[model samples]
Target: MSRFTDFFVRNKKKLLIGIGGFASVIMIGFVVFLLNRERILKYAVAKAIQKVENKYPAKLKIGNARFLDLNTVLVTDIALLPNDRPKLMQIDTVEATVSFRSLFLGRMVFKQFDMAQGAITAFKQDSVDNFSFLYKKQAAGETVDSTAKKTSNYGTLLNRLIETAFENVPDGVNFRNLAVLFKNDGRTINMNLPTMLVEDGEINARMTITTEALTNTMYVKGVIDPDNYLLAAKFYGDNQSKSIEVPYIQQKFGATMRFDTLSLSITNKVYKNNQLTISGESSAYGLVLNHPKIADENVTVQNGAMKYVLTLGDHYYALEPESEVRINKAIFYPEATYETRPKRKIGIKINSPDIPANDLFASLPPGLFDTFQGVQATGTFKYRMNFFVDMAQVDSLKFDSDLDASPDFNITQFGPVDLRKLNQEFTHTVYEKDKVVRTFQVGPSNPNFTPYNQIPNHLKYAILTAEDPRFLTHKGFHEGAFRHSLITNIKENSFVRGGSTVSMQLVKNAFLTRKKTITRKVEEALIVWIIENLRLTNKERMFEVYLNIIEWGPNVYGIREAARFYFSKEPSQLTLEESLFLASIVPKPKQYRTYFDAYGGLRAYPRYFFKLISGNMLKRGLISPSQAASVSTYVNLSGRAGSFIIPKPDTTHVQLMDTLQLAPIDLLDF
Candidate 1:
């Protein structure tokens, strides 16, 4: 170090003068560079774009890419997809400067900024839409209640996020609020939202998304009365005066309970299928439940069927014919346990080729065919639906297929056909199409299609008290119910035990074949499990469907038809005596004729079976002793005489042949 200093001292004055001149020039050059910062920035931006294109292999369509004075981006355009239209995006125009502190300290610090108009648009699937800027909440009332806010974790976290992002925002990125929208009117939709924060996976967005897929989107872009949405309930709620469109709204329900303690309620509203909905402005932490009122509301009578509207709080439920039935739609919600709703009586319409009457008759249980005195046909036929809502209401009835030409009738070949005799019995087998497939006809008491919704409530309670007491509280497949049935089976050593709920009855009746394979039973169990989560409770439509489509003899389908055939009277007129007869024979239709000697037998069921089922009903508070005693008596089971042949009118004729033709049956139970 000493040697070097001695050498430098010899030329210290010359070195000092020379170094001073160089230092002055360098400082002067730097000052000039800062003054012309805009030019340098432009050059840098151009180079950066070129590098970007070279660095990544892509064919991105870019438009109006710019760099203004002092790192300002005046205008920009980026196209993510191919379209016939052009996309424009603009940030507020302004003059700004780069922060020298950031440049030297490796920290981002900007200053001097301004903004103007900015908009973002994205189109997909023949729709147009746009996104806009946001405004902060400015309300009068208090939400946190001061004391709670002091100890709120979420409140504190929100505070931190706002503080961190704005620290280095600077004036360069300033902009006025954004304005964006989307509009479509016919079979199309366009929508957009700009400047959104998508934290985690859920979105807390306040924007509009409109589409032209329905009748109208303009009229449907706001709040609506929730009750009108239900298909069945709409008819009774003054639909004639006002009908509205709803394209972007849905309600979500939540509960914290289990069997006997099951509790549920709805929460914040969201767009359809939950696009980007948030909590109510003043929603509480927990939601309160509004259970549906069935049969308790008004019902409409139309087209020979009763139309009952069921509402859960203000939301609409299903629309179905009047009859005895069950749905698991939050079925046991009142019980507050883990239970699921099954696919039941409700169904969606489909557009498919009609099934030949002959083809449908070919699909029946092995021996069940030809067993009925005037029975007919074989094989399976089905229709294809365009869309569907496969809920409990839909699950109850089996959707075989629309009937084609009847037994020997053809629609295309029009001949002399008597319209007045459509349902009348004929000597020659006649096929009919479009006739409602069911087990019985409904009068005020029967209420076939829209029978009073109240009827099912009463009937279900009765049936439940008469059948399974635990139906309301258990999941679809009740192990306890199963165990009891097994014990009974062991005692009697017979397959006369069934712990299946009304839901299970619908399943086995509608879908599964008559085979007693474990695999098939397993499938039934699984479907029942699904029903527990997805269906409603008891329904009148369900029972009506069960009775109408069920066979009593050859072609004897519904309770209406059966009532007329057996008693020569309307179903509504059949007293308790006749109703019990119907219930007794249902469990074993094939054996009905044999056991009753043609339904001339046990008006009541087997000893243990009746007690077990009836006891369950009693425990559930479904029936009175009078009702039980009335159901226990037999109207005409006076002797062991299997003379249960369907009654025919004097005008009705039956053609007998070695190979007699009969109507197909839907004996859908084991």
Candidate 2:
């Protein structure tokens, strides 16, 4: 027992030494693990940086990078594009804490991560011609439209620049958060995303992308900084990837924009095709209108009004006003209101009562009124109405005259007139015969506007038969007839005929009439092409137009005067038979003539010749059967010398809009 104790004492020291050595070895292993951790983290960081450089902007700037734990690191910085410019996306600092525990075992793992203080800013600039919806805008001194001097030359150069800005960013893309795990020997990398925010007071949202190019899964979250407007975003890939300013592409443009309150929160996925499905609303105020025509001189008072809604990328905002407007009255015009909502059922009544009224039925025809009469009427009259004549629901009709007068005629002798059909016509019809001229009247003559319920069915059908038959099937211009006309004109080398529909005719008459040459025809075709894109309905207005202005006659050039001179009645009263009789002389008057008794008294001959014009057009289905029937009613349709008169609207109602901005006009859409 004594010897055992002595040996124990000496062996105790040896045992202690052995114990220390074992502990030292263990400590050394731990130190080695911690020392190489940053290296592993750096390697991972380098790999992630490479991805951003390859996929997005190449100029990634981080403020600093540091170790967060024994096996994890954190990095923060401001990001830039390859061109090195401060832009839409600017991050003060982004913290990416990465772990490297698995690196010692020949693997990578990110254990923890965080990002703070980032934002995205969107701006509308005062100078718009400098901007392009297709790409980021250039700074001052760069002419966006180099062809402003020669608009024909600038598109190519601008396109090249736009291409370069978006070349690296594939159109369809999505990203999500990453996940990683680590063990005793190896570690796992994860790209897990944190929450994110968008700009312009938008709802906050989450973004996830599934893409083959990104190995199919990426998680992304971000929030925009209210103060600086930088998007603080976090991304997670298959591996916990550490990237500096991964969202720098949007920041390349300096914060030239001042946002009111840009907020956003949303979640959506990107597919293999790289399409981002973002479902959220982003609203902004005072978005600059980028129209080139927005000059002070061009905005004062205009011949016509224009409205536009501009769209920037997927983002949209209110387009600014084009004309300086003033509000004077709250009166509503039926034509204007109906134009606003045609399909809806809404009716209003006339409000003002001060408008003086009269019935000009007797004075409406052409031969009866002087040229000065129409002008005197337009200048002196002002109209106020509750509902539009074209939009109102009509139940019955009453005809009365000033100072009490009646026409000495019977229903059977005169024939029934298609009142509803007459209202549908857009033409300015004047009836005139020698010293008797009259224009068609549209209303009850109360001086207030009223709307029409339905175009007279008979007139509608008749005009359809006589005018544009393929109106329903064709887009705007009849293709078959147009092609035929073009070929014939080309072969003949003279401008003779056309198959342009009533819509096309309206386009030619109202929107444009620059030159009277084939080139004008080419421009017309181009305009028609654009109009087709609008898809207009209710096209009957075009067929009703009366185009007899520059005529070769004696004080007679309008439908109202011509009708009154020959038929001794208003155009609205022109029977189907009388209509056919008048329609015959339109193409060329002198070619067709009626019976002329040498004794000067009216006489019926055994064989009389009348131009069968309306008949031919009806047989060809150019007009509706109802119109043909109306033409058949005129017992003695005359084709002889008559009083000349121009057709004009008997009653005119013009509504003054309170403000131009009530509808989107003035700003051009992107």
Question: Taking the tens digit of each residue's C-alpha lDDT, what string does model 2 give over 269-299?
Answer: 1122221222222332211111112211111
Output the lDDT of residue 108, model 1. Answer: 26
Candidate 1: TM-score? Answer: 0.29
Model 2 Cα shift for residue 575 (angstroms)? 9.4
Which prediction has the highest lDDT against the true structure? 1
Question: What are the runs in model 1 whose C-alpha is more than 4 Å off?
Answer: 1-32, 47-115, 126-174, 177-466, 469-670
- Tell me the whole-model lDDT of each prediction, alpha carbons only: 0.36, 0.35
Q: After superposition, how far is residue 593 of candidate 2 from its true place, in Å?
A: 21
TM-score of each: 0.29, 0.29
For candidate 2, the C-alpha RMSD (Å) to the true structure equals: 23.3
Tell me the spans in candidate 2 whose CA falls farther than 4 Å from its real position: 1-31, 54-57, 69-72, 83-90, 99-464, 468-562, 565-670
